[model samples]
Target: MKVLLLGSGGREHALAWKLAQSPRLTTLFALPGNPGIARYARCLEGIPLTDHDAIVTVCGAEDIDLVVVGPEAPLVDGIADRLTAEGIPVFGPKQVAAQLEGSKLFTKELCKAHNIPTAAFGRFAEPAGARAFIEAQGAPIVLKADGLMAGKGVIVAMTLDEALAAVDEVFAMGVPGTEILIEEFLEGEEVSFFCLVDGETVLPFGSAQDHKRAFDGDQGPNTGGMGAYSPAPVFTPEIERRTLAEIVKPTARALADAEAEFRGVLFAGLMITSAGPKLIEYNVRFGDPECQVLLRRLDGDLLALLEATANGRLAGHDVTFRDDAALAIVMATRGYPGDYGKGSVIAGLDEADAVEGVTVFHAGTRLIGDRLTAHGGRVLNITALGTDVREARARAYEAVSLIDWPEGFCRTDIAWRALKL
Candidate 1:
């Protein structure tokens, strides 16, 4: 099968790598892919991701058997709708369905209407209204920008002053125009639960614990993702079962009832509290570093699964993962989640990948002659597989240590929680 994968990030790189391993794959193309992805698939350059017309044209020209979207931004921008409208099958939800991630308020409303378990939230269109709600909710509340801010939208405030400050900051993004979401704080460990939905059938794809904070010990500002480990220990078999039955099932039913009928990966940001699992948020596509770890542990014909989902054949198939744990440590530009220099030459990738059970997935990297240069905040995802998370994490960091990029940084504790177990 000929495949066209979209996006230019570590997630796409991992997807491309896995898809390339399928014997059924005849040719693989990554649209404007990065350096690492280019090794596994032919990278289509110059065409912007938003150019649906160009993508559809290429799909026809390349006789692409399937189009898999790797990021939420394009999916939320209606790229899937456009591709499907052009008679090309796409593995992504439409714009309206993608509101699950595009607009925080939209998901909150969906949860309320469907009786889904989530934090009690209030939506506001003005700063003052948001401030009043923050005061009413008191300290240890949550503040979120109603619109997507690339995973930096939500803020967990531990005090009243911080809560008010978060509102002010979000509102300062714009007043009446700025949308705000203030919700009751649910204290607990967080895990990412992902499922693939082909309208009717919901298949549990994978699970991972993502470190969203920029630094170790969760002490820094939010980032796209600093690192991650797969098959989170906190999300045990029972939790997975309950998550599917209580959260994933109902959301799929609600989407079907609403005639949305999801067609791609649904990432649920979950808070596993004493009260069980509650929704923290949702992402219409796979998580970054989490995707790196999950894909490393995915042990089946990935192409077959993607094709099945895209063609609505999910009911006949079950998503599978290796029992072994996997971990991904993100190597970032020195000042990542903030300002950082770009185009610094990177080295030692070959040595890094030579480490047993390790693979380096590129993000924000470009091949400039014989050198790979950093081109974005999150630069590389060093993923490793092992019998347990501790071993996996050790292997991942070992590979990370091999990388020779002075201008890059990584969180040393990628799976500290699971490691503690």
Candidate 2:
């Protein structure tokens, strides 16, 4: 099958790599792909994902069999709806269904209406109301922007001053009628639970835990992700059962009832509190560093699974995962989640990839005349597979040590929670 994968990040590189391994794949193409993804698929450079007409033209010219969207922005922008209108099978949800991630208010309302387990939240259309709500809720509350902010919108304010400031900052974006969502903070271990949904069927894909903090010991500002490990130690069988029964299944049923049948991966960010798993948030697509590790532990054909999902034939198929653990440590340009320089030459990638069971997936990088240079904040994902989290962490860091990028840095202690457990 000929496929057109979207996005230009580590997640897309990992998806391209795994899809390229499928024997059923006749051809693979990527739009605005990174250097690492270019190795596995034909990179269609300079084609912006927002260009729906150009994407359709490319699909027609290539007779693309499937268009797998790796990022949520395109899906939330109705790219899948566009492709489906042209009779092309696309692996993603339509704009209405994608509102689960695009609009925090929408998800909260859905959870409230459907009784899906989630934290208590209030929606405010004005800054004064939001500040009042924050003051009433006290400290340690989560303040989220109603719309997407590339995973940095939500601020877990530990103090009253911080919470009030976050509200001001969110309103300062200047989008009129922008709603601020203040959620009651719940303390627990968080895990990323992913499932493949084809409108009717919800297939359990896998589980992973990612470090959201940018620095070691879980200190520093929240980044896209610092590192991740598969089969989260805290997401046990019973907890998985509760999550599916109380949260995932109810969500799928609710969306279907609303006539917005979802088709793609539903990434549920859950907090395993003392009561049970509660929804933290949702991402319409797979998580970045989390996807890197999940793909490593997958034991079946990814292309076929995605095709099945797009066609709504996922009811009978089941996913399989390897027993071994996989870990990914993100290497970022120094001073990430903040201002940072770019165009720094990076070297020793081949040596790093040569490490046993290690593959460096590029996130923000450019190949400038045989020179790999830093192009974004979060750059390379050093992913490795091992018998356990400890071994995987070791291999991933070993590869990190080999990379000769002076401007890059990564957390030394990944999988710290699992190791402690």
Candidate 3:
């Protein structure tokens, strides 16, 4: 089967890698793909993703059988709806369903209306109203932009000053628009749970713990993802069962009841606390570095699974996983999630991949002639799989140590909480 994968990140790279391994795959193509993904798929450039006509033309020319969107931006922009309208089999939710990630306010309301377990939140369109609510909510509240801000929209404010500052920063910055959400902070360990839902059937994928902090010891500003490890120790079998019963199932049912019938990946960001697993937020697409690690652990035919979900036959498909754990450490350009330089030549990638079980997936990198250089905030995702989290961490870091890129940095402890156990 011919496949056209979208986006140019570590998630797309990993998806390309996994999809390429499928025996059913006859051809693979990535739009605006990075240098790393070029190894497994034919990288195409100059195709404007926002242009639905251009995308349709490319799909027709390439004879692409399946279209897999990796990022939330294009999905929220109605890429899937456009493609599906042309009878193209696309693996992503439609634009209406994408509102789950595009607008925090919409998701909060959906959860409230459906009685889904989530933090109490209030939407504010004016700064004055937001400030007044923050004052009443007290410290340690979660302030978020209603619209997407590339994963940096939400702030877990620990103080009243921080909460108020975040409100001003998001609104005054004029980046997140006029709306913001003030949510009651929930105490718990965060876990990313993914599922493949085809209208009614929900197939559980693996879970991972994402380190959002840019620095080690969990101290820094939030990033798209610094690093991640799969088969999260926190999400044990028992917790998985409870989460599915009390959280995931309810969410899927709620969306169905609302006539969304969410298809493609349903990423539920959960906080497991004394009160059990409560939804922090919902992402319509897959998580970046988490997808990198989870894809590394996937042992079945990815193409078949995706096709089943797209065809609304996921109930009959068997999605299996390997018992091994996987870890992905993201190598980011210096001063990421803010200002940073680009085009610095990177080296030692071959040496990094020489380590057993390590696969380096590119995120923000480009090939200039023969030299690989940085292009975005996060650059490379070095992912590894092993029998346990400790081995996976060791293998992943061993690869990181060999990489020679002074312009880049990564979190040394990717999944310390899970590995320590």
Candidate 4:
């Protein structure tokens, strides 16, 4: 089957790599793909992903059988709806279903109404109202922008001053924060749990832990993702059962009850607190570095699984994952999630891939003649799979060490939490 994958990031590159391995795939194409993805699929440049008419034209011209969206922006913009309207098969949530990630306030309200386990929050459109609520709630509150901020919308304030300042930054500073949701910060360890839901039934995928902070030891401002590792040690079997019963299934059913039949990857960012597991947030699509790790450990035909979800036949399909653990360390430009230089030449890609079980998926990189150079915030995702997390971490860093990009840097302890345990 011919497939057209969307987005230009490491997640898309990893998807392209995994999809390319499927024997069921006859042809695969990526729209404006990065240099890393070019090795596996035909890169179609100059076509705007937001342009529904143009994409439809290309889908017709290329005889594309399936369209898979890799980013949340396009999904929030209703690209899937447009494509499906044209009789095209797309693997993403519709705009109505996408509100789970598009608007923080919307999801919080839905959770409250449905009794879904989540942090207590108050939504405000005006700064005065938000400040008043913050004053009542006191310190250590979580302030989040209503709309998407590329994984940087949410702020965990440790003090009252910081909480108020975060509200001001999102509301008064006009940083794409017209509305904000301030929630009571829950103290706990966090884990990312994913599930493929087809409105009626849900199939839980493996768990992964992502480093949202830009630096090591969980310091610095949040980026898209610093790194990630799969089969999170924190998400034990009992925790998984409770998460699916109390969080994942309830959220999926809640969306359906609200007349939004969600179909696609449902990413639940959960906090396992002393009280219980609470929802941190929800993502409509696959997580970037998380996708790199999960895809690396995936052992089945991805194309078939996606098709089943898109076709609402997920109940008949059971997704399998390898028992081995996978770790992905992200290599980013020096000053990422902030101002940073670009076009610095990168080297040692082949050597990095040569490491047993290691796969380097390109993110913010491009080919300038014969050299690959940095172009975005998070540049490369070096993923490795092993019988254990320790081995996986060792192999991942070993591969990352071989890369000779002076302008790039990565966290030395990508899976430190798991390793420490």
Q: For candidate 1, lDDT tens digit of each residue in 2-88?
A: 899998999999999999899999999999998888888999999999898999999999999899999888988999889888888
Task: Please give the range of 10 consecutive residues that has the lowest summed lDDT in model 2.
Answer: 170-179
lDDT of each: 0.89, 0.93, 0.88, 0.89
The digit string of per-residue lDDT tens for model 4 on 1-421 reads 9999998999999999999988889999999899889988999999888898999999999999999999998999999899999998889999999999988878888888878889998888888898899899898888887777898877888888887777777774334536778899899889999999888889988899999898888899988999989999888899989999988888888878878889899999999999778998999999988998999888899999888888888887877899999999999999888899989999999999999999899899988998889998889999999999999989988998899998898888788888884
- Count the clashes in each prediction: 0, 0, 0, 0
Q: Which ten residues in a row have the lowest lDDT in candidate 3?
A: 169-178
Measured on C-alpha atoms, candidate 1 has an lDDT of 0.89
lDDT at 87, model 4: 92
- How many clashing pairs in candidate 3? 0
How do the residues 283-348 of candidate 2 rate in per-residue lDDT, one tens digit apiece? Answer: 999999999999999998999999999999998898999999999999999989899999999999
Q: Pick the candidate with the highest lDDT.
A: 2
User: Which stretches of model 4 miss by more than 4 angstroms?
Assistant: 172-177
Q: What is the C-alpha RMSD of each candidate to the true structure, in Å?
A: 1.3, 1.1, 1.4, 1.3
Off by over 4 Å in 3: 173-177
Model 3: how large is the Cα RMSD against the reference?
1.4
Sorting all predicted structures by TM-score, with the top scorer first, yields 2, 1, 4, 3
Q: What shift in Å separates residue 28 of candidate 2 from its native position after superposition?
A: 0.3
lDDT of 2: 0.93
